[model samples]
Target: MSRPRRLLTLGHSYVVGTNRRLARAMAQAGAGEWEVTAAAPAAFPGDLGPITLQPEAGERVVPVSVHGAGRIHTMRYGPELRDLLRQEWDVVHCWEEPFIVSGAQVAAWTPRGAKLVFATFQNLPKRYPPPFSWMERYTMRRADGWIAFGRLVAEVLGARGIYDRRPHRVIAPGVDTTLFRPDRDAGARIRSSLGWMDDAAPVVGYLGRFVPEKGIETLMAALDGCAQPWRALFVGGGPLEAEVRAWAGRYGDRVRIVTGVAHDAVPDFVNAMDLLCAPSRTTRRWHEQLGRMLTEAMACGVPVAGSDSGEIPFVIGDAGLVIPENDVAAWTREIDALLASPQRRADLASRGRARAEAEFALDVVARQHLDFFDNLLMETR
Candidate 1:
């Protein structure tokens, strides 16, 4: 048999082990057909703190030093990456935005024979300024293909005519089903730990950054208007933490706000919820890219309710409830309707879990990536 195709994937977010699940999944899914290696920053500043490279099983990961570590647009990998890029490979996949300086560097260094693919989650259509725009143009000129993390991204970039004739695919990010599956015991444990031993009221949860753009105020108002007896659990930390805490104070023990949660522990909190809400509000510059938390909740057998902002509706896709982004009354009515009937919640939970397994599971997503790569390689050959 001919030698297996070698693949190299580079991303800054790979510093976190959980985020490297895609690389691991690719390696496993492509076994005997492809050889995979991932290059990540040795250490990078994260929202909670500095994140050190954490390698997972069944995959090869290289930790290279980086300059301007946390600055997405400005950071550049050290000489080690340049040296690695010189090596022969069938494909070089970049997880950075094409408009960033590092992306330009990768595009410039990739071997001539290799297929280069860049992944992006940018859904907005604003024209970037100066060097960023220059970098995007340069990178796209050399790219063999690109991957958009959501449909919105593909539509936005496609409209700009940047990918006119190039092959591109819309692939959503994957979630580890094994790590995020339903566990009644785990849910009970989390609720008990949070002093919610009674379990009499259904717990409504939010699992993302506590920012204004996340529609925290809208969520608060909707919950206040909820006629049904419900408990709220907010898992994540951001600039709006103080505001969230102050808002939760009025509810006494009906609300809980958790901060600095590790990625692995996320499933426990998710399982604790009867329903998950993603109330992201679109702003001038930003919109919900994928709403990863939606998949996680669905994977945990928890129903979800999301706003119509950006990709939320697409991600939910009839599996769960979709409310208006900033419509307090709509959110209140929908949330109340779900909370009023366990039968409805159970139906949504079942559908959501099925959707997660079929569309968002790691193995499913990994196979999609491999198929796309296989097609790209075949076209070139």
Candidate 2:
């Protein structure tokens, strides 16, 4: 007998790639019994044909297309996208971007009796321009159901009246435990690559967009306020690079900024940190919906300190400290306290590693997602 018809996922680059990792975990867990295909804007023409994941993320990309006409502006897929959606799949899911409206558009236009889901990752207010948001909401209402990455996201949608009184579920983003887990061998290599000498100062790291919403400026200010011999390292590039560099200059040779690093190298980057901090502020267009980097750091057995923005407090739990957003003084105190107590930092690291392995382990997370999708298809049928 042939394998079970399974999932078709629609998403932008990040999500599509993450879902592929889950699919791999599913395959390894004997959950591979189903057929899975992704409908994201690929670099080329056809389904990048079924291929195993390479250490290089580029090797796993599948092909897809997008038509020009749409209610939302997708990142421009080719015309082949529609036919891919019409294929026999038990469930269809749209990822973070409206790329396929997380696949609902393709599903709605497909023949009847399809289980379509829209995965909404925004915990903050939608930033899309006026009239477009109305149409976007309408398209989302058209889906069979919706998916929220976490409780905070679900609540935000619920509070903002985004959920159309339709069925929805909250399943958080996952990390690849196998690749990101604690590796003693990789730790020294990571430190060496980053140029941290025995006499080098403690490293503080941040990962994500460097835009105003990310509150990187606040981080820079807080770091400058601290008297400790510290080096701030960043793994992402954003519009505020020049400003950030200028601000760091006041602290002398205490800041190092790398434009950006690939996702596969995130573990090494976090492993190189003495502490990872996300100083995201809750603002009109801002909220750190899910602390993806913090989780990645935890997976690397590193302690993280972040603010109580959006799901961050929930994300951090008891694993690390949470200070008020935009409070440079509190930020200083938190860092100083952590630096003063190595035992506390060690405890946080242990707790963080436990949390990473228990809650967000790739295999467990993938299974939860697979079961959720499987149940949704069964119920809708």
Best by lDDT: 1
lDDT of 1: 0.92
Question: Whole-model lDDT, candidate 2?
Answer: 0.70
Q: Candidate 1 at residue 329, lDDT?
A: 97
lDDT, residue 143, model 1: 92
In candidate 1, list every pair of residues with a backbone clash.
none
Model 1 lDDT-worst window of ten: 157-166
**lDDT of every predicted structure (CA atoms):** 0.92, 0.70
Clashing pairs in 2: 48-63, 65-78, 66-77, 66-78, 94-102, 94-103, 95-102, 98-101
Clashes of 2: 8
Candidate with the greatest TM-score versus the true structure: 1
Error of 1 at 110 (Å): 0.2
TM-score of each: 0.98, 0.85
